[model samples]
Target: MGVVDEAARLERAGYPVIHLEKGEPGLDTPAPVKQAAIEALLANKTRYSHSSGLPELRQAVCDYYASQYGVRIDPRRVVVNAGSSACLVEIFLALLSPGDEVVLPDPGYPAYPRFITAARGVPVQAGSAVTGYQHTAELVREHLTPRTKAILINFPNNPTGAVADAAQLAAFAELGPIVVSDEVYHGLEADGCHSRSILEFTDNAVVVGSFSKAYAMTGWRLGYLIVPEHMVTAVTRMHEDLFVGTNTFIQWAAITALGDAATIQRQVREELNTRRDCLLAELPRLGLQLAHQPRGAFYVLVRQWANTGTSAQLAADLLKHAHVAITPGSVFGPSGEGNIRFSLSAPADQIVVAMRRVEKFLVEHPALAPR
Candidate 1:
C-alpha cells in the first residue's frame, strides 16, 4: 500500500506513471453486471437483506460451485461480506483464541498475518516459495504446532501465481488443521485450466472467494465464504455484528455475475494471459529472473539481478526513475526479498512501455547491471 500511495502522490504531481502495481482487473465491470445492479436499484431492491447475504445470491453461489467444480454446497453455509478480507477477519475472529497460531505461506499476501494478528492469533510463516511457491502439505506440516488453528492457502496465488492440483489439495486436507482456502483467483488461470477447490477434496475447509479478480468486480466490494456446516452460525454472527449486511443491489447483481460468469471470466482470462505472456517473455531479457513460471493469476514476481539494495529500494528507484510502479517483493515476506512483483492490471501496450522504461533506466544506471 505504501508503494501505491507513493505512486498516487507522483500521479497527483502530474507524473505520467505507468501502473503495474494494482491487483484488480484492468477492465471495466461487465455490462451485464452493471445493468443488473441498475435494474435492482430501479426496482427498489435497495433494502437490506439477511446479514449472511441475499438468499438468491447465496443460492447462485451454490449453483456456481455445483456446475463449475462439481461440489455441492448448502446455501446455509454461505456467508457474504463486504469482501473476502472481511470474511477472513470474521473467520479468524470466530475460530481463533488469543495466541492461537495460523500457518500462512511466506511471501504470501502481506495482509494475511495482519488479519490473523488483529484477531489475536499468532501468524506463523512457512517457506512456500522454497518449493516454487507451492504451499504443499509437507511445508505446512513443518510449521504446525499445538497452537496452530488453521492453515491459510492461496492458490493461483497473488505474487507467485503458482497453482496446486487436486493431489496437493488432498494432501492439505489430510493435514488436520482447518484449511482456509483463498480461491479468489479461481477462474484466472493462464493455461485455461480451472483450479480445484478445497471443498472438492474435503468438507472440512473454509473457502474465501471474491468476484474482485475473476469477475472484474473489484469496486463492487463483494465476496463470500463457503464454510463448513458447523461454522456457519459463528461466522455469520460475527459478520452480522460487524457489518449488518452487504449492499442489496450489489447482491442482486452478483447473482447476475454468477449467471454469466463463464462468458465474463473467459474474456478476462484471455486478456490477462496475453499480458502475462508479454511480461514473461520480456522481463527475462532485461536480466530479471522470473521467480517461477506463473500458471495463474495476473502477477509475475521477478528477481532483480542487478540491484544490490533491498527490493523496496529497487521498487522505489524504479518509480522515481522509470516512472513505472511495481510492488517490492520484500513487503510480501522475507522470502520475497530481492524481488519485485509486476501486476498485469495494466494494458498490454502500457506494460510494454513500462518495461522499455525499466530497460532504459537500467542502462543509464550501469551500477545496477547484473554481476
Candidate 2:
C-alpha cells in the first residue's frame, strides 16, 4: 500500500486525523501578492500571456536572483510554466533523448523517475544515508556513463532536508553532464544556512523554482525555469506547447510576491526552524532515532527500533493508533526503508498537539520504544 493513503483514508472515514502528510504552506498567500492578483483580475489582465509568460514576470524572476543571491541572468532565459512540476516535464522532454540516462539520488523525490520515464529517459538512482541523503559529487561521478545526459539535484531537499555543500556543488558544475537544479524551497532556509543554485556555479545548468513553497502560493500554478541561452529555444518551445504560459493573474501577483518578500520570508523561516527544533527535541523521547538532523527544509525522517512492519505499515499504525499522519520513507526509495518523514508544514499549534498524541502512542506501546 502507498504510504500517503493512510492519511486520506482516515480523513474520509472522519477519523479526526492530524494532517502532517502534505507540504502545502500553512499560511495564506501574502497580502501584497493577493492584492496584486485582485488588481489584475479587476483590470482585465486575464489574457493568455506572451506564450512564454509576461516579460515582466520573467524579469521579476531574474531580479529576485540578483537581489537575493548575487546571481545574474538574462530574463529571456527564463521559461515560465504552470508550476515547477510542469517545468520539470518540459525540461526532461526537451533535454532527454530516448536512451539517455539521468543520475538521480535514491530515496529522492519519487516524481524524478516518473518524469524521466514520461520523457523516455532512464533515471539511474544512486545515494546512501551515509551522506545524509544529499547527492554527493562522488556518488554522482560514480553513476556517470557514456549515456549520462544530466544529473538532478534538489537542495534544501524534501523528505531528508539536506543542503548541498558549496565544494560539492562546484564539483558538480565541473562535471560534464547537464545539471538540473530544483530550488523550489530556496528562500525557506533553516538557521543561517542557504541553498545553492547551480546557476551560481554554471550557466549550463537548468534551474527549476516556484512561488509555491516560499511565498505560500501552492495553488497559484506558477513556476519558472532558467535555461542556458542555447537551451532556451527548446525549453520555451516545449513550454509554449505543453503549458502555453503560467496563469496571467498569478504571473502578475508573483511579481509583487517577489518584491515584497522580506518580512514573510523571515516569518516562514523562523517558524519552520522553531517547529524543526521542537520536533527534533521531542521525537527522541519516543525513542525514534533521527538518522540525521536536517539543516534545511522542514522534514525530519526518523526510524523506530520496533518491528512495526514496513514503513508503510508503520505509518498506517501511527495514523490508526495515534490519529496522526506522516509519510513512509520506502515510498521515496529503498534507502528510505525503516523510516518515516514528519512534515513540519502543519501549523505550529497542530504539530505540538499532534506530537503529544504521538508521544502518548509511544508510551502506550512500550514495545515501540527503545530501552
Candidate 3:
C-alpha cells in the first residue's frame, strides 16, 4: 500500500509510471455483466436480499462448480460477500477460537495473515519456498500442531503463481485440518490448463472465490464462499451479523457473470498469457531470475541478483528511478525477502517498455545486475 501510494504520488507529479503493481486486470468489466447490473437497477431490484446472497447468485456459484469441476454443491452452503477478503474474515471468525492456529503459505498473499490475526487466530507459516513456492501437504504437515484449525492454500497463488494438482489437493484434504482454498484466480491460468478445485478432492473444504480477477469485476465488490454443509450455518451467522448482505443489484449481475463465464474467462486468460509470455522472455534478459515459472494467475516473482539489497529496497528504487511500479515480495512474507513481484496488469507494449526502463536502471546501478 505504501508503494501504491508512492506510485500514485509520482503519477500526480506527471510521471508516466508503468503500473506492474496492481493485482487487478487491465481490462474493463465485461459488457454483459455491466448491462445486467444496469437492468437490475432500472427494475428497482435494489432491495436487500438474503444475507447468504441472492438465491440465484448462490445457485450460479453451485452451477459454476458443477460445470467447471464436475462437483455437486448444495446451494444452502454458499455465502456471498462484498469480496473474497470479506469471505476470508468471516471464515476465520467462524472457525477460529482465540489462539487457534491456521497454517498459511509463506510467500503467499500478504492479507491472509492479517485476516487470521484479526479473527484472533494464530497464522503459522508453512515454508513453500523449498517446494518452489508450491504449498504441499507434506510441507504443511510439518508445521501442524494440536491448535491448528485449518490449512489455508492459494493456488494460482498471489506473488508466486504455482498451481497444485489433484494428488496434492487430496493430500491436503487428508491432513486432518480444514482446507481453505483461495480460488479467486482459478480461471486465469496462463497455460491453457484449468486449475482443480479442492472440492473435487474433498467436501471438507472452504473455497474463497471472486469475479474480480477472471471477470474484471474488482470494483464491483462481488465474491462468494462455498463452505461445507456443517460450516454453512456458522459462517452465515457471522456474515449476517457483520455484513448483513451483499449488494442486491451486484448479486444479480454476478448471475450474468457466471452465466457467460466460459467466454469471459477465456478472453482474460488469453490476454494474461500474452503478458506472461512477454515477461518470461524479457525478465531473464534483464538479468532477473524467475524462481518459479508462473503457471496460473498474473504474477512473476523475480529473484534479484546477489547484493542488490532487500526486495523492498529494489522495489522502491525501481519505482523512484525507473518510474515502473511493482510489489516487493518481502511484503508477502519473510521467505519472499530477496524477490520482487511483477503483476501482469499492464498491456504487452507497456510491459515491454517497463522492461527497457528496468534494463537501463540496472545498467546505471551495476551492483544490481546479475553477474
Tens-digit lDDT string for candidate 1 (212-270): 99999998999999999998888878778889999999999999999999999899999
List clashing residue pairs in candidate 1.
none
Quick one: RMSD of model 3?
0.9
Q: Per-prediction TM-score, please?
A: 0.98, 0.96, 0.98
TM-score of structure candidate 2:
0.96
RMSD (Å) of each candidate, 1 decimal: 1.1, 1.6, 0.9
Query: TM-score-based ranking, best first?
Result: 3, 1, 2
In model 2, which residue pairs have backbone atoms overlapping below 3 Å?
none
Off by over 4 Å in 3: none
The C-alpha stretches of model 1 lying farther than 4 A from their native spots are none
Residue 96 shift from truth in candidate 3, angstroms: 0.2
Error of 3 at 306 (Å): 1.8
lDDT of each structure?
Answer: 0.90, 0.83, 0.91
Tens-digit per-residue lDDT, 134-207, candidate 2: 66878888889999999998887777888887888899888889899989888777788987778888887999
C-alpha lDDT (0 to 100) for residue 225 of candidate 2: 88
